[model samples]
Target: MEKQIAIIGGGIVGATAAYYLSTLPGGQQVKVTLFDDGLGQATTAAAGIISPWLSKRRNQQWYQLAKAGADLYPQLIHDAQLGTDVYQQTGTIVTREIPTDLELLFDLAQERRQTAVTMGSVTTLTAAEVQAKIPLLANAQPGVFISGGARVDGAALVAGLLAQATAKNLTIRRERVHLTAQGQVVTSLGARQFDRVIVAAGAWAKELLAPLGITADVRPQKGQLIELAVKDYPIQENMPVLMPEGERDFVPFGHGKLIVGATHEDDGKFNLQVDPTVTADLFASAQRLMPSLTTANITGTRVGTRAYTSDFAPFFGPVPDHEAILVASGLGSSGLTTGPQVGRLLAGSALYGGTPDWSEYEKPLATYLKPSAE
Candidate 1:
């Protein structure tokens, strides 16, 4: 009697869970079926910037998990032979004059007892420092601090994970899933009974769990990005730039291109339309940060939905009252930064019995074992 687990969604979190579950101790006996309707389109559409230090938060659980995931990226890239260039470990720079709430960030760092380097009086960078780091920013303002960070090709990572899962004999079904009252899951293709079912459906987790009497306080937040082609721009080596006090991030990617994003809108629209207003704002911001980008060719634009939790933390662990039903959603903007660790934790919990204790990572529906009155 081998254990069987069904995971819904093939985004970062779901796919990572599938990969880890298949590699768990004595995992050979466990069969994992991964279901995804969109298949790595939603949450995986992120810029894939891995910055744990920049994710400064009041909650230690999130900080810990984010750091853990960041640590895992290097190894994951190596294991997949995805090339070191696929991940930029050039670190991140947060400008000082960006009206950021440094008091909060410093307080969080202090609470976590993490070491932070404070450069004197410089709230922003001078044109020289900016040029030194990112030659493209020869005309940028002053006040900047560098933090340890990394950026990865998020889409490539997803593709590599799926390929690896296939090599390991895991089943991936591209279809929607409907769940039964007895914790069974049926897909458009077929029905299967699992010892455990993990719902990692991202934005749609709430809708999928509704019929099962489980509530996932998750929503879709639309974000957009623009790709720029700059063959000669002197972009920083693997460096990510945060702007407007961390409201958005600018990341460089493969083949002399950069990704400028994103707008956090709660309009619940999934259309890939790049809002002109948003794009203008993004372009202005990017040009201001890196002047060399002014000559860069606007390659293309894309829009994707991020799964957000009411409390802005991921939903992991088992669904209350249904021991066999588990959840792994609501990763929000940090899916790429936290997916690997969350997946490892969820896989361990599913195969074993106890959910990993991450008290500070709040899930909105964790307290609601039953649906609210309709």
Candidate 2:
């Protein structure tokens, strides 16, 4: 009999898993189904920043995971062979508002260089240089520029993966899936038994796994972004993604438009509505970063609930006692960067009952996550 596999959530992880499952060896015999709720999806609302090294996380496991995630972008973009309407290695700039922050990033660049990690060339730019490149910064603080950083459109990437997966014989279903205590999977369309089920439900993963006695240690973090058009004040064509310290970051979305994201608030609210306060703060930050933004048109706003893990690493692998019930969630603010890697590993583990070669960080990560602690 053929293996039955069900993937809950059609976000990046779920979509990538389906695409890889359709291509991995021994994956041909497995019948795969993907479920998507089509509501409040984090993937769609994400600013899709792929610059993980800019984060302050110092955990080795996390560093490796994030590095691998960033490394996969070029290949993915090429594999999809789609136009560069969404994914591109535009690189990132980590601006420093103070001298202390600049010193810290310089040290980090040295360490990253010694390890020969592919973080692109790390260049220290003077305050004026930053403003020259962006022309938006009123006070161009000195910062470290990472050449390997890339930008992605979360929604577009997911759509591409799903489209290719469909061509490879994967089934796509728009349904809210339910799992019974008896281990059966059901949906409004019908009920069925799957030999394996992978949940990549993003913010909603906790709700589905709680009843199964599995603690994913995941929480919903609401982030809001305001879109603006740069028609009045033109930016450099090869402009890099900018994180000019503090609470704001600017991402260019091509053709005189940019996305400034993400207020990280862990309130348990799921409304996904634009907050007046959030809008005001981000807009103010944008204008400060580049006074030119004052002339840009406000292209509405977006809100998403990203899944954040207690240990800052995504939840992956089997759900404790339930071998058939696997999970990949809590990718945090950098989900777009790590989503593809999570999919590849989850797919491999499901097919072969062994630790993946790139999963050396898994053991220590599992210990910290404490999915099922004593």
Most TM-score-accurate candidate = 2
Clashes of 2: 1
- RMSD, one per candidate, in order: 3.8, 2.5
What is the per-residue lDDT of model 2 for residues 178-291, given as tens digits with 9 covering 90 to 100?
787656788896678888898889878777876665555777888888888775345444578887777487887668778888788888347788888888898988887767
Candidate 1 structure quality by residue, lDDT tens digits, 142-253: 4344444567766667777777777774788878888876777987756678898988877777777887777667778888777777654545454444443433567765
Runs of candidate 2 exceeding 4 Å displacement: 232-237, 355-359, 363-374
Model 1 bad stretches (over 4 Å):
98-127, 143-147, 233-247, 291-296, 360-365, 368-370
Per-model clash counts, in order, read 8, 1
* Residue 42 local lDDT, model 1: 61
lDDT for each candidate structure: 0.68, 0.77
Q: Candidate 2 deviates by what RMSD?
A: 2.5
Q: Indicate which candidate wins on lDDT.
A: 2
Residue 167 in model 1: shift from native, Å?
0.4
